[model samples]
Target: MPAPLLSLTWTDHVTGRQGFLVVDRLVRGVCSGGLRMRPGCTLDEVTGLARGMTMKEALHYDPSARYVPLGGAKGGIDCDPRSPEAYGVLVRYLRAMRPYVEHYWTTGEDLGLNQDLVDKAAREAGLVSTIQAVHPLLEDETEARARLADAFAVRVDGLGLDELVGGCGVAEAVLAALDRAGHAHAGARVAVQGLGTMGGATARFLARAGLTVVAVADVRGTIANPAGLDVEALLAARDAHGGVDRAALRPGDRELPGEAWLSTEAEILVPAAVSYAIDEVNQQRITARWIAEAANMPVLPEAENLLAARGVTVLPDVVVNSGTNAWWWWTLFGDIGADPDEAFAHIRRSMRALVERTLGRAAADGTTPRAAAHALVADRLPEIADRFGWYATPRKDAP
Candidate 1:
């Protein structure tokens, strides 16, 4: 892969925690991704995530749709979000990055961070919005912002629409794969790692779709049961950080090692938490027929190769987790309204089509799904560039 277009590191003046930003590739003078705050985050990790965002944006390109996918960028801060100082570090980091956020990068929530908190910090950092950079692309910025704010306010079963769309996309990918394989969703066991925004919603959707959620791993440990755990109960009892309250566990639930989520007897494993969760060593324990990555880069390259050799299909994160990012643009650009039903319907249709196209190419090219996704992005980038040009020019007509 080529080096990122722009990269910078910022250290909080008070906390001394480091933050990194990488614009992997830019189209139309701006890029889109999210901000994640987690301890031990590194520049390399942020770079990988930015590149994934590039692929994600390209994969969702549709000439007919109103939403034009932007280029990719990401920001990460090396501090645990639960810490009291995390908020201050985020404010200082955003203040330091105010220039880029204003001119080139449009970011939101990712991983350890959420959109509300990011917006709050961005305001404290003297910005109009965390996504203010993309406002220039809007036909009517006021209408677009109102639509997005409304969409963000929409919720289903007490979960925000923004939080559930990505998981909905992942569930659709899983269902698409099952439909192609003639696998019945009824008895398919799914083990999910991470019970946060992505995982909780994914579990809810899958469980509603008739799949058995045999295990869910939070930061604490793995909660398992052979006969499907109560997903709704677990979700309701979940803390803001995504950890389930142990008191909510029903009888017959077993608490296993955190890594047990990998080896649990299940047809599918959804890793929705952290990157590099499955390395070469831990991969040998995964016996699932499919691993859908709800988190970015959860499976490293070598582990993916090993899993592929064993016929374990691994869906790339770019395809599986692209829904959330797509939904934001779809809402803001008027491709879809701030309606929960419309949003869910759009996500399902788009994700299913994307999965089918990606898997079909994988079979034809004799390559992994990740490679197939890369090829698709490679095909679309030039088309986007050809139409939009490499860089956007200054608009004389101002707001």
Candidate 2:
């Protein structure tokens, strides 16, 4: 495993809030990742997530890729978002670490943090944000302007960026996987585990794309219908109840244990919740033909290996769910002169191509897609390192 380039921990004297920032790699001169604030957030979790960011950046980078002068890093604060002191704590935290944050790392929202809060904190700390700096420029085109306007409005309301694009990306990847497996999406069944932003968006997109979302799960429990559930109604109910409300179930929908979502017998299973939700113990119980990771690191290595051995097509998170990062890359480094619609169209094309290439490479090499992606990055890293002076010269007297 590659060690992080730098790790820094901080504590707020007033609120007794503590957190850490881990920069796993520096591809260029800068590093970027999300800032997650949760009660159970830990240094180890942040470190692992930082490393995952590095892998994500590596997998996304190619010689012909656009200029993305960023590495991978992650930050977390051990405080619950529901706490009354959340805003004050975040401001102090950012004020204390402004220099490091401004010079070395750029952060957006993760699990418990939202972009609006981050922006507020950044402003309070006298720190300029890359997101804020570039978001305004995307308003030059009609469609892009509308999208940015909606995203900005949503952010102001403390909601995350529109997950429609991300969901569309997931749906596209599912279709690609099904096509590769010689299956059709028309009437294909998909079970989405989690009704949060990503999972809910994915479920909606899949349904819109003509696939049947046979089952859906949230913190409350799983509600399934073999004949397809009304995704729009389900989302509305979830929004009202903070989860899948049992009272909102339709006549044909049946509520089952949350774990039942994992074994719901679908062509595609999307684990879009917490990390490591599918592990060794329950890997054998998975009944999906394809496992698309809509959440970060949803499958542990052991579980992934078991699934791969069993001939399940596991679409890695880094590739399938890279829409957010890709959007940021476009905003930060894409052709500013181009129309916003054109820029987004380019991203869609590139993402689809990446999925196709990774799947093709995996098939040709007889390896899992995750392994194939890592191998591609591994093969390219030395060259990047050499160019960026990341390599150390060997000493003549060294043993």
Candidate 3:
């Protein structure tokens, strides 16, 4: 892997918390990713995520599309999101990274953080918008911003449209895998970890698609029911941090240890919670035929190898979770409007094609999905750079 163009570690003065920013590459003088706040976040983890963002961007590139892919970048702060000091630390970190956010990096929510909180913190830190760095590329900045805001306001069921797009792509990927294996969606069992923006939405989509969401894991623990838990009730009962209230579970629903989601009796498992959630040891307990990475680096490479050897398929996060990032750009760049149906149609078409190509590439090359995705990215990035120029030298007049 190539080195990141820039990497910085920041120490919060007020709370003494540490934060990290990694710019894996630059395209047209700007990069894009998300900001996550969680305890034990490290530079290494952010580096991997930033690189994954690069792949996600590359895999979605269409020369004729209005939303051209940007470079990769990520920001992370090491502090518990539940702590009172967390918001203050977030504001301080954004303030410290303001220059980059203004000129080079465009970020949004990831993991412990949400877009609402990020936007608020960005404003308090004197940022125009979390993604204002790309304003220069917009044909009409005001109209584009308004379009994106309207899109964000759109909700399907009870969740914001933005939150559902990623999960939409993920569910589509799962469906694609099932199709390839000739598996029936009607009764396929699924277990998902993390009921936040991604996981909760994923469970809803999968359940609605006729797949039984037999188990879902929140910060509290795993909620399991063989006949399938009530996804809507769990979603309604979620706290801001993705924890489920015990009272919301159905009569037959049982709570298990936090890690029980891994061992749940399910054909598909989604680890959407944290980095390295499935390591070598824990991976041994997973009986799921397919693992979709809804979180960045949820499966370590070694564990993935072990699973692959055991006849499991691991769908890489770059393709599965890229829809959220792509949706933002699609709306901002006028590729799609504020319509939920249009947005979902665009996501499904693009994500389905992407997943099909990735799986096909893996089959032809005899490589893992992650490796195939990486190869696709490796091929596309240079073409993107050649056509648009990498903008290796930072522009002095950048705002």
Candidate 4:
């Protein structure tokens, strides 16, 4: 991985709130990523996430190509999003980092932060709330472009554009994997861990595509039905209570232990929750033949190696969950006249292509898709750096 170009730490004097920003790589003097607020987010975590963002952006649509001029960066505020002081803390944090926000780093919401909270904080800080300035820069005069810009600007409050696009991308990747494995999508069973924004969206889209979402797990517990759980009911339950509502369980629905979602008998499993959900300890228990990472780094490096050894096709997060970054890139640099359906179709096509390419590379090289993805990005980065003159000159104290 390339070293970060800049690292900054700041604290709000009044609130004593602390945050860190890491610019992992920059292209054309611009970097973009997300701002996550959590209780124990560390500088190392933020730095790692920034590096992932760089790979995600570079390999989002096509691992063999670079689609956007933007680079990777990430910011994290060490505060509890559930606290009543979240709003105030966010405002203060954004104000403290206003110069960086405007000049170098543009961020949207991630993890504990929502679009509404981000917009409120950005407005409070007198900064543009939109993820990227789409309206003024877009040259297309089509009605679709205008609607897309409007939707991108508002982001539907809590749902957000990232969730919508990311979910669609995951579903698309699942289909691609299913095809590669010689399975049909309609009757295939899927187990999903984590029913938050990304997970919920993924479940919804997969169900819409005719896949049976046999099991879904949240922080509260896991719910399963061999015949297939009702995706609509589960989604409504999650929305109403922010998790699986045990009270809303239907006749055949059965609750299992939280970790049981991993062991469920299914063809496809999507871990869309926290980082390292499938670590060294539980990697042995994963029964699904295909693993599509809908969350960032859900499968640790060692765990992925074990899965690969077992002949389970593991799609890396950089490829499977890159729709958010791709959406942001398109909004910033793609053709503005694309309608929502057209835009989403493009995302699905791109993700499917990447899945096929990565799987092919893995087969040809006898490596896991994760490693193949890293090799592809590593191969492309140097050419981009040299062409754009972004190579960091060595310094005496750098190493």
Best by TM-score: 1
Question: Which parts of model 1 have CA positions greater than 4 angstroms off?
Answer: 396-399
State residue 213's C-alpha deviation in candidate 4, in Å. Answer: 0.5
lDDT of all the models against the reference? 0.94, 0.74, 0.92, 0.77
Q: Per-residue alpha-carbon lDDT of model 2 for 249-324, expressed as tens digits?
A: 8899998888898899798999887777899999888878899998788899999888888878899987887776
Backbone clashes for every candidate come to 0, 0, 0, 0
- Write the residue-wise lDDT of candidate 1 on 274-361 in tens digits: 9999999999999999999999999999999999999999999999999999999999999999999999999999999999999999
Model 2 regions more than 4 Å off:
14-17, 62-66, 130-161, 240-248, 335-344, 386-399
Q: RMSD to native for every prediction?
A: 1.1, 6.1, 1.6, 5.0
**N/CA/C clash count, model 2:** 0
Instruction: Tell me the lDDT of model 1 at 169.
Output: 99
Instruction: Give the Cα error of residue 66 in candidate 3, in Å.
Output: 0.5
Output the lDDT of residue 134, model 2. 29
Measured on C-alpha atoms, candidate 4 has an lDDT of 0.77
lDDT value for model 2: 0.74
lDDT of 3 by residue, 200-223 (tens): 888888999999999888877889
Which of the two candidates, 3 or 4, achieves a greater TM-score against the reference?
3
Query: Global lDDT for candidate 3?
Result: 0.92
Best by lDDT: 1
